[model samples]
Target: MAHPLDYLYFSAVMYTSLGIGDIVPTGHMRFIAGVEALNGLLLIAWSASFLFAMMNRLWDWEPCVEPKDEE
Candidate 1:
């Protein structure tokens, strides 16, 4: 049937954090979109967190090194 297609279509919309206002769902289906939106937000946050951690691990990123005064 078209159920999976519809789910995926809406999910794709959700993935991009886009609500085109075309596929409006009724009743319980409405909750699905909300969940998708939340998922998208969490995923975006998670990606940002992961990238920050990766960068910290990869770079020396040192600041305020002690100055060496040669006598």
Candidate 2:
């Protein structure tokens, strides 16, 4: 059995696609790790794009804090 903390660390490494190689997933776990890495990559990309859109809407290339008033 694997320790909880070790499992967590492994999951995080998979999620981040770091591939540190310290711990290797075997059998079915390998598929899960691959999926997790893809999911993480997509979510990160989505979040970044969403944030960029929000920033575009909120500021017109200015460092202002107030959100733009929508008509």
Candidate 3:
């Protein structure tokens, strides 16, 4: 890219898989873009798994018991 801002914008689009179509990568850059997209996806999946596990650990799952009525 002729300008630094162009590369930054292109990298952002690739990592997020936005596919905005405003800028296109060529040759080796295409492979780099694919890798960036994959990395982003993996990071997101890993984060979700971690959050789910944390929530499960923190939640109280015991069922409530009703008191017996005495005559």
lDDT of every model, 2 decimals = 0.84, 0.89, 0.83
In candidate 1, how many Å is residue 46 off?
A: 1.0
RMSD for all candidates, in order, please: 4.3, 6.4, 4.4
- lDDT (10s digit) by residue, model 1, range 1-71: 46788878978887677988777878997787789888998999999999999999999975678876799
Q: After superposition, how far is residue 26 of candidate 3 from its true place, in Å?
A: 1.2
lDDT of 3 by residue, 1-71 (tens): 26999888888887777769788888898888899988878887889999999998999766579766698
Model 2: weakest 10-residue lDDT segment is: 59-68
Query: In candidate 2, what are the lDDT values of residues 4-59, reduced to their tens digit?
Result: 99989998988887879898989998998999999988988899999999998998
**How does candidate 3 score on lDDT?**
0.83
> Which candidate leads the pack in lDDT?
2
Better of 1 and 2 by TM-score: 2
Give each model's clash number: 0, 0, 0
TM-score of every candidate: 0.66, 0.79, 0.67
Q: What TM-score number comes out for model 2?
A: 0.79
What ranking of all candidate models by TM-score puts the best one first?
A: 2, 3, 1
- Tell me the deviation in Å of residue 48 in model 2: 0.7
Task: Return the lDDT, model 3, position 18.
Answer: 79
